[model samples]
Target: MIKALFKKEFIDTIRDKRSVVAALFGALFTPLLFAVMMTFNIEKARSVDDVYIEINNADMAPQIVELLDRESIFHAELPSTGKKFELNGETHTHSKISLTFSDDFESQLSSGLPANILINADYSDQERSSQIRRVKRVLENYEGAVLNMRLVARGISPLVIDVVDLEEQDTSTPGSKSAIILGMLGVFILFSVFVSSTNVAIDCSAGERERNSLELLLMQPVSTFDVVASKTINTGLFGLFAGTLSIALTAVVIPFIPLHKIGMAFNFDLEVAVKMWFIILPLAFFAAAFQLVTTFHAKSFKEAQTYIQYSIMLPLIVPMALEFSKYKHAALDYLPIVAQQQAISKLIRGELTDFTPVIGGMIVTMLFSYGLVLFTSKSLKSEKVVLGL
Candidate 1:
C-alpha cells in the first residue's frame, strides 16, 4: 500500500508542468548567473594591463623622469598639466606628485639644501594606487642616489642617513581567503535544495488537498503515515536530484572562474564534495517537511506556492548576511537552513567536520520532518484541511 502511494505521488509530481519547469530552472539558473558574472569580472580585470599616466614636471627633475623611464613606467608629456581624475562626470585634481620645481633646483642640491618638488594623484583609485607605489619606489631610489652623492661630496658617510627598515608579515592562510566565497556558495547550494523541493512538496500536499484527492487517498486502506512518508520521500528524492545537478554545475564552474584575483581559489576535493552532499541530504528532508506543513494549511495551489516562494527568501537572505559580515554562526547547528549553511561552508573551506553538529542537525531535521508528517497526516483526517475550510 505504501509502495503504491509513493509511486503514485512520484508520477503525479513528475506530470505537473509547473513543478517540472520550476525544478528545471531552479537547478539551471544559479550556475548560469554565477558563471557569467565571474567571467565578466575576470575579463574586465584582464583588459587594462597597460595604464596611462601624464606627467607635468618635465623641467624640474631629470632624475625622476629618467627613473620612471628605466622602470618601463610609460608616461606621455601633457601640457604642464596637473593630474585630473574624471569619474562619473565629476573631476578632481591632485597636484601633490605633480612636480613644479623651484627655479634654482640644481643650485639647492649642489648646496646640500632640500629642494621642493610637487607630487599629485588620487590615493583612492586602487589600480592607480598600485602605479603610484611603483612610482614612489623609483623616486625613493633616486633620492637614495642623490643623498649618497651629496654625502660623498661633503666627505660624510652615506651610512649616517640610514634609518629604520620596515618589514611586513602576512599570516593569512589559503582557507581564510576562501572562507567568504565558501559561505556564499554553500548558501546557493542549500537554497537550491530548498527551492527544488518546494514545488513538489507543495503540489503534492496542498494541491491534493485543494483537488479533494487527499481525502480519497486517506479513506483508503493505507495508513496516513504512509501517505505522509511517501510525500516526504518523493519530494526529497526529486529535490536531491535537482540539487545534485546544480552542485555539479558549480563544481565544474568554480575551477573555471578566476577567483584568484579576489584572493580565492576554486579547488574542490572529492572528499569535500561527498561531505557537503551528506550535509545537504537532511536539509532536503527538512525543506520537504516544511513545505508539506505550510502547504497542508494553504487553501489553494496558488496560496501554497506563495508561501513556498516567501519561504525561499529566508534561506537566501540570512546566509548571505552572515557571509558578508563574516559572522561565525556556530549556534545554527540545530537550525534548518542555517545548519546546512554553516556545515557546507566549512566543507568548502576544508575545515574539520564536527560529527556532533552534522549528526545533531540530521537528528533535528529528521524529528521535524517526522513531526510535520504526523501533523499533516492528522490534518488529512480532518475536514478542515481536506475540504479547504
Candidate 2:
C-alpha cells in the first residue's frame, strides 16, 4: 500500500519539469563555481609578470634598483589618464605606488647607519596594498644582504644574528593535505539534499492541500501514517537522486581543480564515493522530513515555499557555524550537518578508521526524521490541519 502511494507521489513529482531542472542545477552549483574561482586565483598567484613602480633618486640606489629589476619589478612611465589596462590577456591597473630613496642613502649605508627607503602608497586604500607589499619585500631583501656583509667584514659570523632557527616540516599526507579545500565538497553534498526535495515536499503536502485533494486522499481507507510515510519516502528519493548526481558531478569536476598547484589533492575515488554515499543516505530522509514538516504547517503552497526556503538554510548555516568555531566536541560528530561534514572530510583524507561515527550519525538523523514523520502524521488526522485552516 505504501509502495502504491509512493509511486503515485513520485510520478507526480517527476512531472514538475522546472523543479527537476532546479534540482539538477543545484547539484552542480558549488563545484562549478568554486572550481572556476579557485583556478583563476591559482593561475594569478603562480604567474609572475612585471610590476611597475615609480622610482625617485634611482641613481642614488643602483643596487636596490637592480635587485628590484631582477625580481621583475621595474620603473615605468605611467599614463597620465587611464587607471586600468589590459596586459597579456590579464587586466591590470596602475597602483600609483612609488619608492623614494633618501638623499643620503649611500652615505648612511657606508657609515653603518640605517638607510631610509620611503615607500609611498595610500595605506588606507585596500586595492593597492598588494603593490605596496611587493615593494616592501624587495627593500627588506636588500637590507638582509647588507646586514650579512657588515657582520662578515667585522670578523663576526653572519649566523650570530640568529638566536634560533625556525624551519617548517609539513607532515600532511597527500590525501590529508587537501582536507580544508575538499571540506567544501562535503558541505555542498549535504545542502543538495534540501535543494532537491523542496519542490516535492511542498507539492506532496501543501500543494495537495491547496488543490483540495489532501482531504479526499484522507477519506480513503489508508491510514495517515501510510500517507505520511509515502510522501516522506518519495521526497527523500528526490534528495537521494540529486545527492548521487552531485557526487558523480563532483568526482568528474574535481580532476580539473588545480589542487596540486596549492599543494592540495582531492583523493576522490570509488571508496570515498561509497563512504560519502553512506553518510548522505540518512541525510536525504532528514532533509525530506524537515521540509515536509515545515511545509505541512503552511496555509498555502506559497507559504510552504517561504517556509521551506528558510528552513532549508539550516543545512548550509549549521556546518558553516560549527566548522568556523574553535570549540568542537565528540558529541557534535553524532549530530546531523556537522556529522556528515566531519565524516566526509575524514573519508576524503583516507583517515576514516571505522564506520562508527558515520553510522551513528545516520541513526541520529533517521531518529529525528522518524520523529518528524510521526508528528506530522498525527497532525494530519486533525480536522483543522487537513482542511488548511
Candidate 3:
C-alpha cells in the first residue's frame, strides 16, 4: 500500500542526520539572524537623540549653548585615542567639527542685527552627517526664540512671520508601517519551506536512483503514482514543519525588534500568526514538489544538489525583487510566492479584508503542486530515468 511506502520514506528521512540539521538550521537559525539584522538596522536608521558637538567661542553665545544642552546636544572633547575615517582618498581621524560664533555675536544680538555662527567641518564626510543635522536643528530653534523676542519687543505678533499655516496629519498605523520594512519576514518563512525539504527530496529521487534502489522499487507491482505520491508526501511534511516553525519563530522574534522606537508597530498576535501558517500551507507542498522535480531531472545526488541549490533561490529572490520594485498588479495576486507575500503583508498590516483571493491562490498553488506530482510520477516510468542513465 501507499502507506507502507510513505512510512518507509519518512523513517529513512528522519534517520538521516543531514535532513534533521537542514530542517533545524533553516527553521531555527534564519529567523534569529533576520531579527539580529533588523535590530542593527533600527539602530542605524533612527536619528541620534543625544549628540556631541564642539564649540569654538563658548563665551560669545551662552544662550545657544544652553539651548543645545536642553536638546541633549553636548560639547564633545576630542578623544585621546583617535578614531579615523576615509573620504575622497584622504585618511583622517576625529570628526573635527566645530561651531565658531562671530566676534561681535553678543553685540549684534543686543543691537537687533544679524549674528553669524560659522559651522566648520569637512562636509564631505558621510558618517558625521547625522551629528551635523542634529546640532543645526537645535541652533535653528534658538534663532526662532530670539526672533520671537524681537517681535514681542517691537509690539508685533510673532505669527506675522508665519503667513502660511501648514498642517500635517499622519494616518499611518504601526502595523502598516512595519509592513513596509519587515515584509521580508514572509519571504524568509517561505524560503524555509524550500530549504528544509531539499535533502529529503534529493534522497527520495536522485539518491535512490544512484544507489540502484529505484530499479528494485519499480520491480514491485506498485503503481508509479503511489511511489511518487508517497515520496512527495514525505518531503512535503519536512517543508511544512519547517515553514510552520519559521512563522512561530518570526512571531516570537519580531516583538523584540524595537519597532516602537521607529514609530512602527507589528502586532503578530495569535490570530495573525495562525493566518500566516494557513497562507503558507499550500506553498509548503509546492516548494517540496518543485524541489523533487528539479532533483529527479538529474542523474546523481551531486547534480541534483547543484540544481536544487539554485532552484531554492527562486522563492527567496522573486518575492524580495517584486517587493523592492514596489510593483503590484491584480494578476500577480494569484501567483504563488507573490500571493503568499501579499497575503502575509496584509495580515500583518491588519488589512486582509477578503478571504476569497487567499483561498483561490491556495487552490491554484495546490493545482501547480499536483501538476508536478503527475509529471514526477510519469518520469519514474521511464527506463533511462529509472536506470539513472
Model number with the top TM-score: 3
Ranking by TM-score: 3, 2, 1
The best candidate in terms of lDDT: 3
Per-candidate TM equals 0.76, 0.86, 0.88
For 57-98, candidate 2 gives per-residue lDDT tens digits of 898899999999998888754647776655668666666777
Cα distance off (Å), candidate 3, residue 132: 3.4
The global Cα lDDT (0 to 1) of model 2 is: 0.83
Candidate 2 weakest lDDT stretch, 10 residues: 77-86
Q: Candidates sorted by lDDT, descending order?
A: 3, 2, 1
- Cα-based lDDT at residue 328, candidate 2: 85
Per-residue alpha-carbon lDDT of candidate 3 for residues 17-59, written as tens digits (9 for 90 to 100): 9988998888887799889988998998885455555687889
Candidate 1 vs 3: which has more lDDT: 3
Residues 1-389 of candidate 1 have per-residue lDDT tens digits of 77888899889988898888888777777776777877786678655343335565456677677777777654543334556655458554432334455677767866778876655667886756777777778778988898898789889998887776668987766567756645667777777887887889888888887777878877778887788889999988877877888888888887887777666675676677778788888878777877887888888888988888876786787666776988675665677776777777777777755778877877887888788889888887778887788
Candidate that beats the other on lDDT, 2 or 3, i.e. the better one: 3
Overall lDDT per candidate, in order of appearance: 0.75, 0.83, 0.84
TM-score-wise, the better of 2 and 3 is 3
In angstroms, give how far residue 99 of model 3 lies from its true place: 2.1
